[model samples]
Target: MRTRFPIAICFVFGIFTLLQYFSKHPTLTAMYAEILDWMQIVFVFTLLVGVISIFKIHSAKISRQERDWPYSILTILGIVVMAVLGFGYGTEYGSPFLWIFQNIQVPMQSTMFALIAFFVASAAYRGFRFRNKEAAVLLITAIIVMLGRVPLGHQISDLIPQTAQWIIDNPSTAAKRGILIGIGLGSITTALRVILGIERSYLGGRS
Candidate 1:
């Protein structure tokens, strides 16, 4: 019952949203807006669930004296400090939440993302060589894109920049858009299946 109910709701609303997108029916359009509102509520509820789960995991780590207990303590402290600042400190004070957000979270996130630069460079060198015709085109595309994004592309000639811009604006953009549209359609279909109870992976095993 627990699994089936939510799955059914998801499928029903998903189908309704899809119909609203493609069909011109006024009733379906109105239903779509209402469903979206409901989804927003569900989203908030899910966020609350996530917060609770995060707190639980961190708390347990501290309580159990797990490996890196100090890190768990730091996580908990950060969460509490941020939550307090988010709710009261900002409104009561000037903008403590925003200050912490800008200084702490943003910098840490950027630092973590910066590690991707090394990983990506490694992957390109190891995996991006041309073994075939398709791979040859891919390698050329990668070279052009790398040059265009970096400051050195202009050193080659103005033609590299022009070619990169043309590739990005035309074939790359069209292919990306097509992939996104396909993804959206797939999501709608999956949602509809959930609502109709046709897909019950969420309900646990077949038993």
Candidate 2:
């Protein structure tokens, strides 16, 4: 029942939302605000459910001595450390947990993203060898766009900004419009399915 409740709520609110959007009455406007506030309260409760699910999964994995047990140990230790730092020990900014988050986690996340530039470079190298005209055009355009935003490129060429603007205004806008329409249609279909009770997968499988 708990699992299915969110889906049921989504359908109920989704229909009300669609109506509220088209509504002209002042009473309906107030109703929308009241409903939205209630939705926030429900969402917070759902977030707690999600956190419990996370804890349960990780706890089971640790208990089973899973393949990556050391990582799970580290995860549990990290969560406990952070919670202690934030709630028990109090944040000193110089505390071990805070320091690790800023120095280790932040830098690790940055370095991981920085690693993506290598993959992009490798892709570009292979893409540049393409013999097909359309692929060649794409590769050239990618290179041009990549260079356009840099200070070095500004010194090297003046035509880049114009080309970038043209691509963004023409192709990008059309692509975005197509994507938005598809998203809207997909959302409506999902909402209707939930409302009709045809999509009960969210309620979890048979016990």
- Which number leads on TM-score? 1
lDDT of 2 by residue, 1-207 (tens): 775777667677877888889987999999999987987998999998986786788888999988887787777777777877788655676777678789888998999999999998898788787689988888777777777767666788788866776777888799999999999999988877777677767666432
Q: What would the TM-scores of all predictions be?
A: 0.72, 0.68
On lDDT, the leading prediction is 1
lDDT of 1 at 107: 100
Tens-digit lDDT track of model 1 for 26-127? 887777778779879989999999989989998899899999989988888898998898878664445898888888889999999999999998988877
Q: Tell me which residue pairs clash in candidate 1.
A: 8-195, 11-195, 12-195
Q: Candidate 2: lDDT over CA atoms?
A: 0.80
